[model samples]
Target: MDIQTILQELELLSTERTKKTYIRNGAHEPLFGVATGAMKPLAKKLKKNQGIAEELYATGNYDAMYLAGMIADPSAMSEADFDRWMGTAYFYMISDYIVAVTLAETDIAQAVSDKWIASGKELFMSAGYSCYCWLLGNRKDEEFDQEKLNKMLEIVEKTIHNSPNRAKYAMNNFVTTVGISYMPLHERAVAVANAIGKVEVSSVKTKCNVPLASEAIQKAVDKGQLGFKRKNVRC
Candidate 1:
């Protein structure tokens, strides 16, 4: 895709009343997190395009700032660059997006993991959890380790269960993205429900609503076979 074209499209999309409602109503924070996660590569491409980057930064939208951070080159960026980009330009932006992009782009996962664990920011932790899950899920393995998978599921479950009201939406976005069609998602959902003292499995259904996997998940659950043990994890 043409990065500039996509950025422009997103800019226009963000201007619509429907989109503006999210910002006006304070839902823009979490929405921007999701957008940042999905648009990192696009942001990197735009960073090299000075005109587009300037326009985006000039707009001062939280989403634009988060996207700019996603595209920033850490290797070439100085502490001064971070100070100016983060402190001066987009003061309204969340620090979570900065941490997320840093972890996502850097090769040093352990270092990022340590930093996030120490920071104890929910959004950053959620982002780290997601990035690690993606890394583990995509790795080449002769057999899937149920223990490790269960641990990952537990992490997501705990996040959703313990999330504050303001961050619940953000947690949901993370769960939906990580859980999209993975059979482990069903177990995670159950754990989340049990942890939070609710019976709402609808979130899982909603996440997979597009391809209609709810029925299949229900059937599997009914058969006493719906945990991470199932082989058909990928959708």
Candidate 2:
């Protein structure tokens, strides 16, 4: 389907009420405020079209950019594409979910993640941590640098308490991903989560709280569901 049709469909699916609700979650205007769940069928229809995704993303509409990430082909993407996407990613949902997921599957995942994290931009750093979460969840233990991950976990343990706004929350997510997705790191993740304790971030009117990493991990463990890796991290 064409971009115009996709956008029209998004508008049909959007509501002013939902737009305001998304605003609370940090969505910028010129968005249809279509929920992520509502966008999946569209993504399925669009499939993975790198050129079209780039076109939609460049429109600067929040929902379209987000959908671009979902439908874009990461295998055909380069570091330059990520750089461009990052420049446009002002929304947390787009940055952390869309940009991060696509980048995490690339061969240069670690390099890109490190560069973004070092930038210390809130969204970039959050996306970087999110990349790590996806990487750890999808890769086998031997495929990555074990020592580096340990040190990264240590960094989270030490600095998560003082990390910037959403970065702390993203770091907490890294801990949860490690605990629930990587079997060998479960103990270490739990320890790190315990040490970090409660994570506080800016409030949403939805009253949704930042989940404690420890409890989140434990819930998975209690259900005998810990250590299972996801087939894919894309939404």
Candidate 3:
């Protein structure tokens, strides 16, 4: 479908309740607040379309931007394209879920994420860590370097508490993901999780506690889900 027709459909799928929830989570105007699940049928129809995805993303509508991620051709996107998208990703959902998730599918995922992680910017760091989480959870353990993951666990242990709110959450998830999904660094990740403890994330609504990586990893262990790998990262 054309962008205009897709946008009209997204508008029709929007609800007041979801709009309020999006606003509460930092989304501004020019959004339809269409639920992610609600976009699946449309996504299925559109598949991967880089041209249309760019148009939708340029609209600056939350739902459109989200749909852009759903249909974007990650292989067609250059590092510059991903960086351009990240530049305008104003919030965690867009940065972590959309930009990072899309980047995870690319061959440059690690290199791009490394630069973002070291960028010292909040959402960039968050998206960078989140991309690792996505990568570790979906890719085979053999694809990662054991030493690199070990160093990352050490970084998380040392800086999680001092990291930005969103980055702290992603960093915590990264540790847990390494523990559960990457057998090479499981023990080190467990130690890092034990050292980091609970992470507190502050927002306008309240101070939320990011789950302890140790506890989350242990739950996966108890369920015999250690060394787990997801079949896909994107919905």
Candidate 4:
């Protein structure tokens, strides 16, 4: 699918009421709000439209740009394009896309890690720390480095301790991403749970629950579900 087709789909699926509600909630201004609502489906579409995704991103839609990073063929992207897109991506998108990239390509792992460290945004930094933990836990090319592991543990601890409520979701995302990458990181995930003083690690467990396209799209196709629209189109 092309960018136009995706945008048309978004317009068809999203109503004026939903858009107004977003505005009412004070989320319409920030670009991430657009992403949180529209970009997931867009990403699914762009998984097959690398060139169109790149073009749409260059048009200055931050949401599209962020989705491009999530769905584009990472190996096909130039280092310059990747760096530019990373510089502009939202924190949460960056966090999630880091997981996608790590899962898909190990050659860019160190570069992605360095970018995550330099992100400076608390959420992004926390995500970087989590991604590094995932790499150590999952990648077989390098043995687990105790010093690096200690550093990640320290950062995770500090992030949880300093901003418990503010960082809760991002922390959960981090743990979830790590768990998805390396199930052995479950112990570290539980440690994150303790540091945040949560009784359960449910959020971490649910963070990586990316449903299949057929399932997610079927939900959208179901009658009475949110975002569902009736039309004569085949899935």
Q: How high is each candidate's TM-score?
A: 0.44, 0.92, 0.97, 0.53
lDDT (CA) per prediction: 0.44, 0.86, 0.93, 0.47
Which candidate achieves the best TM-score against the true structure?
3
lDDT of candidate model 2 versus the reference = 0.86
Q: How would you encode candidate 4's per-residue C-alpha lDDT over 1-235 as one tens digit per residue? A: 6667755555555555655654443233333334244556666645545677577666454444545545555566655665565455444444434433432344565566556556665544544555554554345523445455445545655764444322344444454444333344445644554554541222322433222322322343353342222231111
lDDT of 3: 0.93
* TM-score (C-alpha) between model 2 and the true structure: 0.92
10 residues in a row with least lDDT, candidate 3: 148-157
> How many steric clashes between backbone atoms does each model show?
0, 0, 0, 0
- Report the alpha-carbon TM-score of model 4 versus the true structure: 0.53
Best-first order by TM-score: 3, 2, 4, 1
Off by over 4 Å in 1: 1-19, 25-60, 74-102, 133-160, 166-235
Candidate 4: segments with Cα more than 4 A from true spot: 1-6, 17-47, 66-71, 90-106, 126-147, 163-168, 176-185, 198-235
The digit string of per-residue lDDT tens for model 1 on 48-107 reads 453444345445555665555555455554434433443332211243344344444445
RMSD of 3: 0.9
lDDT of 2 at 17: 84
Task: Tell me the tens digit of each residue's lDDT in model 2 across 1-235.
Answer: 7889889998988878888987877888789888888899988988989999999999989888888988999999898889889998886788888899999879988899989888989889999999998888888877877677778889989887777878887899999988888777779889999998888765544434479999999999899987677787786
Highest-scoring model, lDDT = 3
